[model samples]
Target: MAKITYIENGGTEHHVDVPTGLSVMDGARRFTIPGIDGDCGGACACATCHVYVEGGWAERLPPMEEIEHDMLDFAFDVKENSRLSCQIKIDDGLDGLIVRTPPRQY
Candidate 1:
């Protein structure tokens, strides 16, 4: 399992263990971590799973595919670090991943 930290807009933090092969969105959903709506249920269709990867973890993540890039366009407060949590597959290498949710989804 990989450990992931999720931060809400007001700075609330949730630490979760994400099993390998599941996505970060899965971890948030499993723990009912507030802020990640995951409207599309990990289909990579909606950007409600949007998050900003921080603490240098962004570089460790795989480059976003064109589909994910286009999807993020619909997210709130998109940033260079913005990523759909569903697009980030949790693995041992991502043990200490950290990300922050935006103030709102829309």
Candidate 2:
């Protein structure tokens, strides 16, 4: 399992042990972390699970696909490190991954 740190907009942090194969969105949902609604599940169909990958983890994550990139257009405060949590699958390589949710999900 990978240990992921989820930071809320206000700086609240949640450390979760997310099993491999599940998406980052899944981890947040499993732990009931606020700020990540994941309304469409892990289908990458919505921007509710938007987050900013922190530190060098952004470069460590796999490249964003066209679908996720396009979907991010609907997210609030898009940034160079912005990514759809549902599109980020957990693995041993991402053990120390850290992500922060935006102020608003709309």
Candidate 3:
């Protein structure tokens, strides 16, 4: 399992043990972590799972695909580190990964 830190809008942090090979969105959903609505599930059709991947952890993630990029365009408060949690597959190497939920998921 990987240790994932999810920061909510009020700056509250929820640390979860995420199983390897599952998407961050799935992990969040499994733990009922707020802020990751995952409105379209893991279909890559919604940006509700948007989160800002911190610089150090960002580099460790897989490159975003065109579809993910397109979806991010619709997210609120998008930043250089913006990513869809559903697009980020967790792994053992990603232990201690930190991601901040956007102010608005829609």
Against the true structure, candidate 2 reaches a TM-score of 0.98
Give the residue spans of candidate 3 off by over 4 A.
none
Off by over 4 Å in 1: none
Sort by TM-score, top down from the best: 2, 1, 3
lDDT of 3: 0.93
lDDT of 3 by residue, 6-106 (tens): 99988999999999999999999999999999999999998999999974888878899999999998999999899999999988989999999988887
* lDDT tens per residue, model 1, 4-92: 99999899988888899999999999999999999889999989999999999999999999999999889988998999999999889
Choose the strongest candidate by TM-score. 2
Model 1 lDDT-worst window of ten: 97-106
Model 2, C-alpha of 57: deviation from truth (Å): 0.6
Stretches of candidate 2 above 4 Å error?
none
What lDDT score is found at residue 95 in candidate 2?
Answer: 94
lDDT of 2: 0.96
Clashing pairs in 2: none
